[model samples]
Target: MTPHEALDDLTRRGLLRSLKPLPDNRGRLVVAGETWLNFCSNDYLDLGHDPALVAASVRAVEDLGCSAAGSRLVSGHLDLHAEFEAKAAAFLGFEAALLFGSGFLANLGAVPALAGEKATIFCDRLNHASLIDGIRMSGMKWHRYRHNDPAHLDELLTKHPAEAGETRLVITDSIFSMDGDAAPLAAVAEAARRHGALLLVDESHAIGVMGPSSKGLCAAFGLKPDAITCGMGKAFGGYGGFVATSATLAALIVNRARSFIYSTGLPPACVGAGIAALDRFAETRGALGDEAMALAKRMHGLLAEAGFEMPPFASPILPVMVGDNHLAQEFAARLAARRILCSAIRPPTVPPGTARLRLTVTRAHTGADLIAARDAFAAVARELGLLP
Candidate 1:
């Protein structure tokens, strides 16, 4: 199809996406000269605008300039990068960690590096698109197990048993982004062990919010997977990604992960900010995370009391299901009209017929903010015949 035709098709299907440039402000957004309570942000810890993180970033730019200059193998491997990696590894309970340009890049690089053509991967059906793309790039056979179902994963592994000397890998997300639910990590770990498969858990959503000391779900469960990967964009309130693993595996990824080898190192500003965020987490002992979770639970209660269907409270993410694509967009539009800024999540970000408003609660939000949001949601829902 032609570009215009594809655009037309997407518009008809309510799948077209566009970017809206808005000034950065934690927990609230200004659009068309009006302020709205923002529930679409991933900055769970609300540290993106923290003064300390900003100061650290500015210092790094002053010292090292903006860019990393080149790939790490060439010249871009800065001391700041090394420092952050060391700090992240220790914080996440790993022997070593390798940095990536972004979380998507981390998965694209790490997944293929760890699993090759001779490997077979068993993946959760509802994992993020990054993981799906990474598996495809690996050129390995893979099976999709039922979401969060360890029994299904084990059955798939047994059916696709690894050949002698062939690798087997099981991958999952610790906290699902849209559904706001957590995987049963211990059960999944047992399944991986039973099948002699290496486990890789993506903690992008859970890091700095869902585990003891903000270390992540794996740390909370005391299950050490082969590797734990995460993006700093969420709770770290910065940009970049990393994989924490054994020292030997880190070395292997450096040599084999094409995305890491070919891409430029993370910029100095992000590295500095990440380091500062880690220090903040260490100092506070995850008190901010506790606060955010509590706020999310409270928000969940408010919405539930208003008669909106909600997934069980897991992380700060709470999905208000709308089902139909156009209705979801209308719901978001109505919320925006009420000075609430929640995004309508639609396919292929979510499965078809599962469109929703992916509401998120952050440390920056207050009880009053949540109450206002709840009232807005209830009003919109009643108008749309979604609530009594």
Candidate 2:
């Protein structure tokens, strides 16, 4: 098919995506000259615009300029990079950590480096695209277990027993991004242990929000996987990704992960901002995440009472299910009209027929903001006959 035909097809299927440059003002956003209550951001702690983070970033730029200037192996490894990696390693209970340019690059490099063609991978069916791409890149034998179902994972492991001396690896996300649900970490960990498989948990959505001291869900469950990876963009409110692992594995990734070897090092500003965010987390002991979670629970209650189906409150993410693609778009549009900014989520980001409005609550939002959002959602539901 021609490019025009593909674009037309996407439009007809309600799957075409376009970007809108919405200027952020604190937690609110300006769209078409109107300020809207923004519920689409993943900044769970609302630190993206924090004064301390801004100041630290400015200071780093002043000291090191804008870019890292080379790959980590080729002079891009600044002292700030080493400092943040050490801090992150200790904070996340790992012996060492390696930084990547972004979360996507981290996964794209780490997954294959850790588990190559000689390995067998068992992945959660609903894992993020980055994980999926990494697994594909590894060229390894793989299986898709049922989402968050430890029993299914166990069965898959048993069914596809690893070859002699072949590595077995199991990967999952601690908290699913689109569905706003959590993996049963303890059970999954136990299964991986029983099968002697190395486990890698992506804690991107759970870091700084779901564990004691904000270490992550793995820490909250007291389950230590072989490695835990996270992107700084979410709770960290910066740009970068890292894997917290043993010193041995960190060395292996440094040698084997091509994405890490080829990509430029993370910029100085992001490194500084990340360090400042970690310091803030240390000072507050994850109080900001607690606040965001509380607000999410309150909003969930309001929507449940108003007769909208919702998943149990797990993290700051709340998926308002609207199965049809067109209906999901309409729901988001109605919310935007009411000055509440929530984005419509559709396949192939999610499975087909599972389109939704992926609403999130952050520390920047208040109880009043959630209440107003609830009221707007109710009104929109009534208009669309979504309420029973």
Candidate 3:
């Protein structure tokens, strides 16, 4: 079909979701707008619009100017980028790190670079699309084990022959984004170790929200991977993504990762802002970050009591399961009308019949906000005949 026809088809099928412009970051949705009470963002720490972050970015621009101008392999590597990389690696307890324009780029660059023809990439079934895409794009034998099931991973590893001289790399999201669930990393790591395989983790969701210093699930659980990819956009409240690993692995990716080599490096301002965010995250203990978790826990309890089927998780990502797609869509729309901006995540993003409201809590939300959201959900549920 032609591009115009394809666009029309998508709109007709309800697959096209339009964007409504926002004024500011009043909260998770938008501030100073007709809409309010945003539960749709990945801003777990509510630091996205933090004055400190804004000031830091401004300072970076004044101090470092605007752009990095080219790829890091060319002339794009700035001192600020180097500073952020070093600080990030140190904060996460890794030997070295490489920054990418985005978390998507980090996964896209790292996966294919690490996995080749002689490599088998074992991934969790519920990994983010970037990871799945990366592996598929790598031309490696992509294997999917059941989500969070180390036993399944072991079974896959055991069935493969060691004489093939192929290396096995196990990959998973430290926290599953859509389901709000964590992988069994300790078990998966152990299984990988037993089979002489390398383990790679994408801590896009768990990095700045979990652990003692928010060093991510690895530091929180003391399970370091062969490589760790995380986004600064979400909890770090900044822009860019990074991969922390050993110097050797770092060099290999720098040499071969197409996503990294082709894309222009992140702007100097963003790099400096990332450094500032890392500094703040380092100084701000996990205790301060725990506010989002507390709110999530509270939301979970209330939703459970109110008969909302929530996905099991130990993180701030909270899902309110609604079994039907149309019902989920209607509920989300009605809730938004009440100024509670939750999103209905449906199939292709999530599995069919498991449609949900993927509520992301942040430090910015107050008790009143939570109460308002609770009441709004209850109201919408009753109106939709979802709640008895």
Best by lDDT: 1
What are the C-alpha RMSDs, in order, of all predicted structures? Answer: 1.0, 1.0, 1.9
lDDT of 1 by residue, 1-388 (tens): 9999999998898888898666655697666788779898999999999999999999999999999999989999999999999999998888999999999999999999899658999999999888899999999988999999999998998888779889899999999888889999999999999999999999999888967888889988998999988999999999999999999889989998998999999999999999999998888998988999999999999999999877777889999999999899999999977988889999999999999999999998989999999999999999999997
Q: Give the TM-score of candidate 3.
A: 0.95
Question: For residues 294-364, could you state the per-residue lDDT of candidate 3 as single tens digits?
Answer: 88888777777777766664887888887677788889999878888888887778876887888877887
Q: Put down candidate 2 lDDT per residue, 1-388, tens digits, no spaces.
A: 8999999999999999999776664577776687789898889899999999999999999999999999999999999999999999988889999999998889889899899559999999999999999999999988999999999999999999879889899999999989889999999999999999999999999998879988889999998899888999999988899999999889989998888999999999999999998898878997888888898899889889988888888988999888889888999999988999898999999999999999888988878888899999989978888885
**Alpha carbon lDDT of each predicted model:** 0.92, 0.91, 0.84
Alpha-carbon shift of residue 141 in model 1 (angstroms) = 0.1
Instruction: Arrange candidates, best lDDT first.
Output: 1, 2, 3
C-alpha TM-score for every candidate = 0.98, 0.98, 0.95
> What's model 2's lDDT at 304?
92
The local distance difference test score of model 1 is: 0.92
- On the 0 to 100 scale, the lDDT of residue 144 in model 1 is 96
Give per-residue lDDT, candidate 2, residue 349: 97
**Model 3: lowest-lDDT 10 consecutive positions:** 24-33
Q: State the weakest 10-residue window (summed lDDT) of model 1.
A: 20-29
TM-score, prediction 2 = 0.98
